[model samples]
Target: MKRIMLIVSYNGANYCGWQKQNNAISIEEVINTKLKELLKEDICVIGASRTDAGVHAKGNVAVFDTETTIPPEKIAYALNARLPQDIRIQESREVRADFHPRYDKNNKKYSYRILNTKINVPIYNEYTMHASNYLDIELMKNAAQYIVGEHDFKSFCAANTGVKTTVREVYSLEITKNNNDIITIEITGNGFLYNMVRIIVGTLIQVGTGKIKPEYVAEIIAAKDRSKAGPTAKAKGLTLEEIYY
Candidate 1:
């Protein structure tokens, strides 16, 4: 058997998430079905990240074991012909037989976008979170700095996450606004807890809107209580940008 790794990208507007489910459609299920039909083998991919529903990805990774004679690099072209337009195989290649995507050491980067204007753009509605009030970008930037190092991120994670350790190291976090009044919060981390990125973005939004002081972010991190942080932002605005091995 040979292990093959695939770099997959998808617009997650219509699927439940990356993992296969019993009653719902998912990105992994769709790719697995297509691969089984192509290679005539019962194949299931192990994804690197389990992105939430309505969250998109540009460089998500997955690996599967197969015995096909097809060239590893050629699999991407053949797979794209069968995949939906929203989901495409960017690259595929063979790896060591023991390689696994999830257990490997890697850094993930994600971005959250917000449309901070009074009116919504119809074409971009599905991709961006809309906030009608004016946002102070400088204040948001100030709050993001506190999140740039190792800390206990339980305050930013969802309740009942069930993870044994909540401490995570964030390499960097940045907030920037575009000319069209779109604000983007980009973060790179060694790992993240459930809903951690969304909660961090929401807390920064609260700082920008004067609901919370910029200096209060450190206190929230120290509290390690989920209730001390702001609400979880909507999932549609978040995207998995890249993964570094």
Candidate 2:
């Protein structure tokens, strides 16, 4: 059997999440179902990240082993025919047998989008978080700087994750606003705990709205207490922008 890697992109509005679950339809379940129909073999894909429900992805990665004679490069085209319009395989290729999408990942970047406007645009509502207040981008940037480098991110992580360690290294965090009144917060790191990115965005939003000073972010990080951080941002605003392996 040959191991195949697939780069997947999807609009997560319709699915429960990336992982399969008995109670809800999920991206992983849909992909696996399509693969089975296309190759006529039962298959399941191992995804790099289990993105939260309603969270979109532009370049998520997954791998599956199959005994089909289909060309690896053409798998994407073939799979697209079977997948729903919301999900598409951007690229596919052969990989070493031992290469795993999750464990072999180098780093990942996620972007949280906020539509800072008095009137919410229906077209952009599915992917962007709507914030009515005027956000001070400069203040948000200043707070984001304190989040860079190694630190205990317990405050930013969702509770009940069961992760042994909360310490993680953040390579970069940036906030930018476009002319369309859309604000984007992009962050890159080696790994992340559950809801980590959303929490960070929530905390930054607090700073932008003057709920907290930029320098106060340092105290929150040092506290390592989840209660000290801001509320978790909505999942629909977050997108897995890219994955580096």
Candidate 3:
């Protein structure tokens, strides 16, 4: 048996999440089903991350064991023909049998998009979060600095995440305004907890809207309480930008 690593990109608007679920459709389930049909074997894939519902990915990774005679690089093209339009296999390669996508990851980057306009753009409605009011971009930039270093991100994680340690290193947190109304927050980190990126976005939005001060970010992190943080931003605005191994 040979182990193959697959890098996948999917629009997560129509699926429950990345993992296979019994009651609901998922990206993983769809890919696994197609793989089983194409390869004529029962194959279970393990994903690198369990992205939330409505969250998209550009470079999500997964690995599976297969005994097929097909070449490793050809698996992506073969699988794409059978996969849905929203989900596509970006790249495939054979790796050591011991390679695991999840346990061996180095870092991940995520981005949250905000459409800060009075009227929502129809074209971007499915991908970007609409914020009607003007946001203080300077405040958001200032607030991003507090999360740049390692810290216990308990306040930014969802309740009952089951993570014993919330400490994570934020390599960079950048907020940039593309136009008058489009703002993007790009964050690179060692790892993240459940809903951590969305919660961080929400908190920064609060800072942008004057609901919270930029310095309050330190307070929130120090509090280590979820209630002290802002609400969870919509999952549609979040994307798995890339993963480094």
lDDT score for residue 46 of model 3 = 92
The best-first sequence of candidates by lDDT reads: 2, 1, 3
Task: Give the per-residue lDDT digits (tens) of candidate 1, residues 1-245.
Answer: 89999999999999999998889999999999999999999998999999989999999999999999999999999999999999999999999888877778989999999999988887778779999889998999888889899999999999998988999999999888999889999999999899999999899989999999999999999999999999999999999999998
Worst 10 residues of 2 by lDDT: 100-109
- TM-score, per-candidate, Cα-based: 0.98, 0.99, 0.98
- Arrange candidates by TM-score, descending: 2, 1, 3
Listed per model in order, the count of residue pairs whose N, CA or C atoms clash below 3 Å is 0, 0, 0
RMSD of each: 0.8, 0.7, 0.9
Off by over 4 Å in 1: none
Error of 3 at 170 (Å): 0.7
Q: Compute the lDDT of residue 115 as modeled in candidate 1.
A: 95
Looking at model 1, how many pairs of residues clash? Answer: 0
Model 1 is weakest, by summed lDDT over 10 consecutive residues, at: 118-127
Q: TM-score for model 3?
A: 0.98
Error of 3 at 102 (Å): 1.0
Compose the digit string of candidate 3's lDDT tens values, residues 145-228: 998999999999999888768999999999988855789999999999999999999999999999999999999999999999
